[model samples]
Target: MTFEEQPIDYSNYLPDAPQARSVAAEMVATRQSEQVKAALFSAKQFPRDQQASFNRIMQACQRKKLAEEAAYEFPKGGSKVTGPSIRLAEVLAQNWGNMEYGVVELDQVNGVSKMEAYAWDIETNTRRSMIFNVTHERKAKGRINKLDDPRDIYELTANMGARRVRACILGVIPGDIVDAALDRCRQTLKDGYTEPLTDRLRKALLKFQEKYGVSKEMIEEYVGCGQDAFTENDFLKIAGVWRSLSDNMAKREDYFNITKVHVPSNAEEEFLKLQEVEKKEDVVHDISTE
Candidate 1:
């Protein structure tokens, strides 16, 4: 009996195909039980459903958490352009499998150089693309790696496009508890029903670590709201004190001291002392400006 002719597999032909990679990238092959335990203990107030999602997100963060996974500061206009823009190549390389596939291409049309990049995420099946104007309207001639060769432009845009893909997969780039909190704060601000630190105003507060100084014990001791019920405005005095700070002023310990005492009570003496100090400083400022 003649065997039927076997059909060509064509399946392994496209190595660049997104479907070729494991649908679920292998997570870190370890469990941070202690971290999870601590988080769960602190998050007992979260509803059962959310705790599960939090657990998954936290674990992914730990796995992808590179030592240098730092946030990119938005550069100010007129800042020196000493080098190419910040690139997250290392971050994407470390988490390459997290991405399904990506494409980078460059073109020049009528003297304008354009670069485009696209990154795909299987988890969300989202496509993130970035387009950059390399020369805009400049002579488009005799520029460094970017305007001349343009490969660098494609790669640079690809790096940013990868970050967007990672965000789709992880729900946030630089995935960590800090970013998680910021996302929540942003959502709360969008809702506008609660919280003094609307997303925009939060940048004016002290640096990230000092923005909310109340220790866990202080929250438990002084706060009436349970953990899950707690919102940014819950620290009424803390929010109020920082709200009064001049623009971009570094936070001072004077405000954090409020955490040492119960809220709204037993804190009057300290509050008065702070008010007196402010008045004296204001008087000194008036004399100095003369």
Candidate 2:
């Protein structure tokens, strides 16, 4: 049988009247956990020059923890039955102010569960959403029965949302970087390589290198391309490569050897600095005119 396609108005599910106020108040009043407090304090210990970066890292960790906590409740036997069930409505309610989170009814058409998600856009006050579908069937023979499992659903939803969020975040990154990466990837793809690394891929690898400072030889080994032969594709392959690396990284508490390549000094810095100055100028111009 096909999954239900009824137009269930989520408006009722949305926190309303007193409920909305209560939720908003509770959200505003919620105190940080002891772990978060410790993290923040530890972050403060970083050298003064690095304090801002440390704070940002700590804040990201806190946000991730909160998001995970808010998205799923771990009830006993939750793992044995199905996957973790997502608190979709709750997630939406909590992020209502900052993100446009909403659920769209899905129709089980062609054996796929089609759903749409809405996210709040900070740049534009309007809500932005995307729709994608996944097949209920699994590639593995026995995996089909596990399709409806809560954990599975949660994972799928998380993956979909993650891709969208990554795309959104990419907007904030320098366009030239992205374009460079894409150009490299396209070149590699055109050269009869099954998988050509793109510029996005290269930047991601550089980021990894920056964080961990891996050796040039180690990077060449992992990437399977020689330093001299490291075309734009090889350099930029991080975009696609990151998809898999991100998942593995999530499970590991410590960073691993992901190979690194030398990035030309001052390639991205000058451009990014110029962009920042221009942005500041625009802000100043606006303020002065106003």
Candidate 3:
């Protein structure tokens, strides 16, 4: 089964979370326990400026005997949020309006349990979504029958949506799933790929990528390749590459490692910035071991 993006109708942007929230509350809680909180904090998942406010809220929670709640939230504009995904959504909504969220499967074919998640990026000012055509069937544990499991598509949707938002929208993770997706895009675009170096074509290509929020370095690399006219296949290859990287799948440097994907030497600056950011996230705002 192949996953293709389906056009979203504006009339179908309903997001039903309350029912799922109640059903999976216990499981979600277990997955987000104090231990998990401590570990994530140690991993420096939260932003730095929020660190002081987070500590203050936690201290206040301790005084008020609400440490349990504190583990799930930080003081935010005199309110609170629990999960990272919800916080990210709120951040996007605040920074960029016209935000829409939805999850649905059009037709179930091949036992795929396919669902598409939609997200909007502030920088891009456009709709972004990821659809998976893969199957997710886990083995039952402890003599439990698969049908007896209550963690159904709702749990999967929530989990997958959160993860996609993190990796695609926020650009936090540079993992295998994203890497494979980029590689696939590269492969798809490499057919009859040629660089056109004409003035009009160069400007047009640059404009196309800018509209889609592609990095300047990436566009420059591709535009410098050919001095002739562009072709339909050329458009497909270029669009495929831009759309793939526009989701911010892998860091700029990863393209160098990606065979058939060319990266100019100057693009190393973006990779260096990504490395520095990751290092800071690895060490900063770690939860105290004591």
Candidate 4:
């Protein structure tokens, strides 16, 4: 018996060929499975209600596969980079998968911790904890292994009110330490805030007082008079004057004497104002000139 040739219903058999082909191409690009692509294409052939369920499954599977691939490639680990600028928290988090690395936990006060890690403030020689605070944590998070930009360090320290302390303690006192201090004090006063007395300044004051038998009251009086207002030039001038007296003291084993000296209550204020006056007209004369 001769069989009649049956014309294929290509439309029913193919079933949204364009959409199926497009979705299959996307699946292949996204590293999805052929089985998943076929199932998704088949779902388009079903009733709308059943189609939604199949679509959801296809999407979930695709997502799951993508996630697996990402985890496989990237993995869960910290950056391998190292340097002064790297955020201690991120480095710790990446390597340890959490804040706790080695035996140290993140201290809210100090910051992150790692064994044998080193960090130095680029502006000064001061070494800080390898751990970082929340703010620093954010700021230095993605920095590569390199010395942090000096400006970045300065801004960070200034914002934290730690610059003066760092400068003093590290003996990284800039040539313009006095001027910098004055500027800081001015900003503090302008903001109606109190500036922190750095340990270095305190130590310097104590040493000076001990050497000269100067009392706290005298120091307070000088400070109250705004001796801190002296500009860097004024400080240099004062240092020259002091050095002359010190040289004389070294030469003669006797107490240096100055009769009719106009000792201002506020040395910093007098110093700044006098330096300006001297610069303008050389009107105010120092006892050293005599």
lDDT scores in order: 0.42, 0.45, 0.44, 0.35
- What is the per-residue lDDT of model 1 for residues 90-209, given as tens digits with 9 covering 90 to 100? 333234333333434467675455655455433333455656544433222475432444565455545445554434433322345445633433343335434344443333233323
TM-scores across all candidates? 0.27, 0.29, 0.26, 0.16
What residue runs in model 1 are displaced by over 4 Å at the alpha carbon?
1-67, 74-103, 109-113, 121-125, 136-178, 181-290
In terms of TM-score, how similar is model 2 to the real structure? Answer: 0.29
lDDT of 4 by residue, 183-284 (tens): 333333334314343433455446544555444344434333344544333332223223333533121112222222333346766788988977766434
Number of the predicted model whose lDDT against the real structure is largest? 2
Number of backbone clashes in candidate 1: 0
Cα lDDT of candidate 3 equals 0.44
Clashing pairs in 3: 195-226, 197-226
Per residue, candidate 3 scores C-alpha lDDT tens digits across 140-202 of 454532322336745645665665554344342223323333333334334323554354456
Q: Ten-residue segment with the worst summed lDDT in candidate 1?
A: 78-87
- Model 2: ten consecutive residues of lowest lDDT: 78-87
Query: Which candidate has the top score in TM-score?
Result: 2
Deviation in Å, model 4, residue 54 alpha carbon: 88
Question: Backbone clashes per model, in order?
Answer: 0, 18, 2, 8
